[model samples]
Target: MKDKLFKNLLHNAKGYSVLNSGGQLVKGYKPDTVLQKGNEYIIMECDTGTSRKGYLGAMLKAARFLSNEKKGVLVLVIKEKPNTKVKQIAEHLQEYLIWLQPLTNLNIVYLIESNRYCPDENPLELLSSEFITTATIIKSD
Candidate 1:
């Protein structure tokens, strides 16, 4: 599953150069993969674990990456739909961010992988109240 997800992301990133792969540490965060196209950075973190910790950790990493990078997109790839616990965590994180009011622009993408063979279909935009206010969902084929 991990391999398929990684492959799908690579396929989607056609012209991007792979900056990091196989969980190499970068600025204290070890994302599954990182790609760069021109001046835009795309940071990807895949979550296949069956626990709340995994989702929370991924969200935390997204926050960290968005906070640090001036121009980048953080994609959180998941094998299945997030559960209630995960949603609750997102809400809490959203509240924290609202209070802190960081100036950086947050472009977080949630990719739900449904098909390993084709992972670039059924694109959807997430509502502001669903998870993070600026988060979007991109369902895989």
Candidate 2:
């Protein structure tokens, strides 16, 4: 039930699919959910686990390359909503973001849990918001 619901909500996002050297789409990477809005392209890796340093860096690197050529936002959406887990990921993602901002046109947004549209002033400022206000504002305009 949870997976089905998530898929439905997530399916609305569509963007250019990234192709590899072999002319195949990458395995773990998902296409940007929202199109280029103000030169901001959001790429979200909807993970269902706690993020690790290695995994974050690897994902960041991939996003960096894509964002450079495309010029957009790179978001890492995690499913771990527990307080401690969220804190840990926020810290790591921030650290990774510092290094990545200079190299690529990437922006990060994390959505922990969602059964419905989240209400918040700005999820970018408030990481725990139910919906991505950044996406909302970009699309509305």
Candidate 3:
């Protein structure tokens, strides 16, 4: 089920791979899926229906692991659109992450709504150059 979600969400990606225990050991951390485009790598964490706390905690943990990384994106993929309170929490997490960038050296973090894509939406747009401006996932209605 999760695999299908990742495949559909990342279908437009040039290439990607699912990480196993060995892969995680190699990378020092495991993301549900990993997408590579050119020199960039996107490590994604997917959650079915975990609490907002769990979601943000996992994202923070990933950032800590990637503290020395100078590139790449940490993407948090959730199965549904966040509720009002969760959205607020995400906003707070965004602020905290931005502030911690200098210390962690983690570049970007994207919070994506897995089921919100339309045919007209380009998944790659989420990782476009302009993303450098906001560094936050902008899910469409």
Top candidate on TM-score is: 3
Ranking by TM-score: 3, 1, 2
Tens-digit lDDT string for candidate 2 (1-141): 133333334232343432212121256544434333344444444445544764476456545555545755444445545643544766556666666666665555443432223233222322224345433221101
Candidate 3: Cα lDDT at 34 = 60
Error of 2 at 53 (Å): 3.9
Q: Residue 35 of candidate 2: its Cα lDDT?
A: 34
Give residue 114's lDDT in candidate 3 (0 to 100).
52
Q: Rank the candidates by lDDT, best first.
A: 3, 1, 2
Superposed by TM-score, candidate 1 places the C-alpha of residue 133 at a distance from the truth, in angstroms, of 18
Which runs of model 3 end up more than 4 angstroms from their true locations?
A: 1-28, 37-39, 81-86, 117-141
Top-lDDT candidate index: 3
Clashing residue pairs for model 2: 41-72, 41-73, 73-107, 74-107
In the order shown, what is each candidate's alpha-carbon RMSD?
A: 7.1, 7.8, 5.7
Instruction: List TM-score per model, in order.
Output: 0.57, 0.51, 0.60
